[model samples]
Target: MRILQLHVDFVEYLPVKKEIDDAEPLLKNEKELIEDTVVILTSIENGDDETLIEDFVKETLDYLKKIKCNSVLIYPYAHLSSSLEAPKSAFKLMTQLEDALRASTDTIVVRRAPFGWTKELGIKVKGHPLSENSRAIVKKNTERQPGTLVEVVSSKSDAIDNEGSVSSALAAEKDLKSNWYVLTVEGALIPYDGYKFKKSEINLENLFKYEILRKRTVEDQPPHVKLMRKLGLADYEPASDSGNMRFYPKGRLIKSLLEQFVTKKVSQYGGLEVETPIMYDSHHPSMESYFNRFPARQYNIKSDQKDLFLRFAACFGQFLMTKDFQISYKNLPLKLYELTRYSFRREKSGELVGLRRLRAFSMPDCHAFCQDINQAKIEFLKRLDLSVSVMEEIGITPEKDLEMAIRFTKEFYTNNKEFVQNLVSKIGKPVLVEMWDDRFFYFVLKWEFNFLDNSGKASALATDQIDIENGERYGITFIDESGNKKNPIILHNSPSGAIERVIFALLEKSAKMMKEGKTPYLPLWLMNTQVRIIPVRDEFIPKCAELLDQLKTNSIRADIDDREDTLSKKIREAETEWIHYTVIIGEKEVATNSISVRDRLKKSSYSTSIDELVKLIKEPMKGKPDLPINLPEYLSKRPRIAS
Candidate 1:
């Protein structure tokens, strides 16, 4: 988390001095400030006098100390884009700075570019000019001298001892077009240039000592640690990267179910499925405008030469895709749905809870383009119905388990109060509402979906926004049969805020319920392993296998436990994994052609035929269920205000 701000300027001293003054306030009383500034001088690219360069370095150091600033970052910015073969001045300056800083402070951390005798011995150069040439040399050399391209080395010997034997062994490799070698050091092989014999380690520990990485261990672990552990991810450590854990097996199961659910529901409702990129140029009106208001949540990519950012919402992209396409009044309400990944900003480090506030996560995002206010309301109700249906299918009940609503307040409805009122009336509920003050901004009308956690705390699970501002910003328009151009009202909605968050909530809720002597009852569809066939004793193994085969043939998620563990242990493991049902087959059941079923939540067992069990599970899903209306009439009638 440590961030180092370097100051490298040889042209002016006054601005450099001012920059220090500005940066000091940001670090004051926060991080340890180094004591003495170090200055380094080097010969110019054109072989200019070394004495003059040395004089400038000494003067700069003196000036820095006079201003009560310590710790200097020296970089020869002049030589970076030069045509000279080698800038000796830059090298000399670096060496002098390193020595001076070390002498002045015991905790001095020096930063330097990677360099080695061969290109292959240093760190990989991303987008480096000499990378192609270096790669060709390493390829040729490794082919000719196989032993020289060492893949593994003893970490203790190479890093701790800094043995020259390892370097020499790497140097003896065959030469290709370029003079570069790959060295196996500290059990970590790095590519380096042939001109330098050694490359310095990044020294991240020491470098970050004065900044964010200082003073704490357990508290400093990144947010992703718990998430990574939960996902059982071992390939890439979550310590340094920004992305959600894509558990292939579990993710595949969840995604398949969601896709099937959405496809069936959307098709039945006459909605269309759309897909878009995960990242987009930040110049998109939605982003530019959003950043203007909430700069903290926006991320920018300087390397792309365009304002590129990870998309936080999918509606903008979907709107862009449909913008230019000709649409008549007949296409009054076109609903588009997409299950996509998005990223959002979490203000503080502690705000990042497992899957709750990830830098990257996926959601079931949808947008409805409506011709009129009434059409928008119709689409909104349909979306509400779908959200409740999906949640119930996944074992979340509205009355006892979930409470959600369309948010209406002064902040969200200041500009379009009437529109918000219409939405609230149509949805027929306001169980969860956040009254806005004068400070609230953006969107004329917005709906927030919430769920009650085990702690009785309500967490917003999703939102649907009537974005008049964004529609105006993007100029999304539709044409009537009379040729009148009208702005299409945009409904920005997500059924689930994030799949990871929902999963985390579910896990916590289940754990709490189990602790309170309740079973984790999953609806028929959402179970990972819907059914588990457990043999009561070794004698019932054959009958259990036969039942498992039948369940699998019926496309029901089912598994057989034929392990050596006791039946209790097997049942416990199944419950831990959140299996929906545990079917126990014993000698009596085997002989009777029946099975004892243990409901996950009920903690009770009953005898039933296999066919009867299937019928019981499928009974609740006989038809499309209506959205639950649990709100008091007074709350439902509350007027919505404009943003």
Candidate 2:
């Protein structure tokens, strides 16, 4: 069966003459829905049975939930397929589908278009990403095709993938077996069954592994989600579709900082920055074939009567841009960068969370073209270092905030084992390495920096992939020393993964601190209000104003707490906002020409001069980008946010 799903603002239809003699009776001559709903354009194919109708309803409702559509309209769209069922069969299937949809879901409204009738449709699709998708659902136990793909395993041990069932995906693994061992901290390979775990490392053995979709046992409201909403950072948009969050002022500030920071790092590494379109024609010859090579699903739209798919990454734009560029071996390592406004992936409803994974999220994508395999490996290692540095800059150290994982094809590893060992040695941790006996997609080797939260959820923060196919696929070539045009190897890296996921990790880390009975705080540079001055009484307001002015002049984020609240209450409020420094000024401090500075992060207080405080804060903030405070300069002018 063929289906196209649409999350529409409204859809209007009017029935016309029946084209077939077995047409089902119409309940209404005209019908329309005024608000959010799902319009399923369905075609019952030649061999469809009652079981097909059952499966179709289940899948249809699943897509509806992802877009938050409760009501559904099952429109008989015979034009979607050329091999349609007989008119009688199609009519019966339509009736059965309508009844099944109502029975399977608690949602009250379910309607179907009059079968065998020509109808006019007026549809206004929602503006949000993932608002529409094209799907092809085949019956169970379909015939499988043969293909050759490489698979490799680290000589030591193998990782279990509950979500992907990698073992099954690679047919070659069926008859072959080897001794699996897990690598230790010192890079020693030990038998997986013989390895012992430390008390602190026990949970790593039982962690649930998934690539994109979230597991069923994942907590509904993890610590980060609660804290994010409470701090007025980001929240869900009920008016928009699910997985597309609405960021408040503070959240936007956080996202912007991370984006700018990573982009600057990429630029400093000799990257040529550019922007690209978000949509491309789905029927473009090369793109159509390229889409099949990718393992991701896409959001499809019919624009001006032409089929188009949203770009899942910066690949399509960058590849298309490079296709027509003039180049030489001298510029072999040509780097391209773009901070994607948003990328859309039709993730399952069960997988959508606060920010760990989203249907629409900002990403900093950088790609480089290398002259040969050697140059590509050189660039790959540099990106790996940058990935570590980015995590460290964000306060996620290798030992504390993140873990490492490397995947490579067996052919590549056999040829260059030393290079892989060097990476593991440099990081000085037990890295999880997976070897594939065959090639799965375009990349030969890839690695990720992951953050595992208390809920046993592991999220990849930074990643670099070595792509071996796209250069030729997109006709991107550079002239070599011999004057012959050669396709270049491409490297894809996100110094930091999705901007939202970075924020998610930061929030989750802070919450973990709170769980351990420690005060949680945002990174110093990201604090919305770095320093807040509180006057003990109305008379000391002038002193507070002077200090705030001096601090701002020195490029320190400072604000005056001018609200009519008690001194104790104000101090508590600053801490709650995760303000890095809170200063309480009074007669004694004003006369002494000093202030008592309360450090929310250090959980301590000390007497210091305005000059001394500025110098101290500057030490930790050196070389870091500064973002404007989303809140007002004076507390009195601001309204309460984040209930």
Candidate 3:
């Protein structure tokens, strides 16, 4: 399976509001046109009144319909501090706006915000009496006390001692400085005095300054900044090493191991490994459509009066390759894999973090074409098995270290809930299903393989999907035994999304495990430097060199540590690099023609001969290691495997 990094612009519909005393004249005036259109609303507040809110919303819907927009997304700006107290009229306006839009036009689609945003907005409204019957259920649930209310008990005469009496009487106070009570009704401790009652008045300014409002407002800033930061575009650093040699020696070793793993595993699965140009003609019909669909992710290049775009996915190239060859039923289940890098877009400036989201990164992309529906299912399952096997080799166990697929509900197509439900049902159970608001209708099944971090949060490591739309769009077809051609079912599956991302996950996971005094278990074969031959003394240097030579002959990733450092320090360094085995050459072992071997995790030593050590390492190396690694043999020898 090939991995991919796609930049997507999360388009949202925002309801705009403009208050005009003369509604009829404003509608006829072109200057008022700016106010009526829904071009991404900003600075929405809770306390906005009814008529102005309704008029703005109605005009925005009309403008959206006029523009022929298929989807109208209600993007909540509640993350902004200004949106804290959206006028009640805004809610009432939206209640009638949907039906009003439906009455006017059937073309435009509408949808609510993502659950994450919805949940956040709900939290903001907690303990708010004005927000008591708020549609946001999360906010209502968090309300401190629904029936209990707070009232202000203003000071009258200086001798009254109102502060002491109020504190003792009320369950809670809105503000201690300004006389306010948790209980709106007067109690025994603080009787309702005519002077204090007369002084108290319910006004918008005081209501907004309420303690609950202040607390919620203050708490909202950090999380909003964090979310915004996460949505920013990724940043790229120039390659420091010349000719891709900028990588540290250890990093190079790791890269080599990953390449080896991918070559062997993908080749074994009958996947035709290929490479394609990173840039493509922007005018190409397929690419043009893709750009329109995900503008934020695709990069455009101008040359010779023409536009070119960085290829966001390898599937298009693979599909284009298939057009050159005529295939029959016998040649069914064709799988194509490529290790390529492409540029993807990001919406926020701070979203980019290390290798997780990058403008350019390498992915192992596999596109499979099958003649029959069952064949497609079988291929997907096989891909899933391979993905799991690879991750396991790298010490990622499905049930323990990793959680494969998580399914959750998301608001689907705005206007066509039934269509979305029908589509989801037909696609079958996704490995990890979450209700996604921004997904295409044509793709049925979508599954993502996730790796749990130290915090137990799942990060997507790989993805698999069945695309029925792209097949028709790209005109990919196969000829059957009856000589009839039909559009082939296409499966876009990536076992490892990006090499940089997988490396990041491995680094984080390994570092955490080591900090906890745990040795990271890696499949013997995928280890960057499989064996580290450490000479106990200068006398054993020759023996170590000889052992290293023997290992190299057997294609074992072995190295010699001839550093002047102590054996213990050398061993510690080797362990830090996560080398699989450490072979220590001491006087006794050299004399006996055996070396003391220490496993990275065990940290316990045992004696083994040169031949025996090679044999031992060879066993695990015979099969594919879990994770994406490159085996030298596969690269040097392009085995003519059938797909």
Best by lDDT: 2
In TM-score terms, candidate 2 sits at 0.73
Q: List model 1 lDDT by residue over 1-643, tens digit each.
A: 0011222221112112222221222222222222233322111334333333333444444444444445454423321213331434434544554465455554434433211111111111112111111011112232454532222221111111011111322221211011121222222212232223222322212222212223323334333333334433212326644444445444345545555565566566666777888777766655655544433343445654765766776766787777766777788777777777554442244455555456566677777888876687677767766766656565655434554443444444455545445544543332323343432334545655555444333456666776555556677778877899887787877665676666655665665565687764435564546677788877777787788777766556666777677878988877765666889988789678888898866668899999988776656545433221111112123232111
User: By TM-score, is 1 or 3 better?
Assistant: 3
Order of the predicted models by TM-score, top scorer first = 2, 3, 1
| TM-scores, all models, native as reference | 0.57, 0.73, 0.58
Model 2 misplaced stretches (Cα beyond 4 Å):
1-181, 184-194, 199-218
lDDT tens per residue, model 3, 1-643:
0000001122222223333221112222121111111222222345433333334445445444444345543433333232344344444444444445455556655443321122211111111111111111112233464522212222211111111111111112111232222112221112112123222221211222332133222222222122112312122235431111123334445555666676677788888898888778866777655543433335557888977767767877888888767888788898889877543442233444454445566678888888866687678777877776766665555534543332222432234334334333432321222333333334555656555444333456767776766777777777888999888888887776566566656655665565687875444654556887788877777887788778778887776777677888988776755667888888888678778899766667898777888888888766654332222221113221111
Report the backbone clash tally of model 2. 14
lDDT of 2 by residue, 442-558 (tens): 888888877887677888888888899999989999999999999999999999899999999999999889989988888888877888999999889998888888888888888
- Compared with the true structure, the alpha-carbon lDDT of candidate 2 equals 0.77
Decoy 1 TM-score against native: 0.57
What TM-score should be assigned to candidate 3?
0.58
Ranking by lDDT: 2, 3, 1
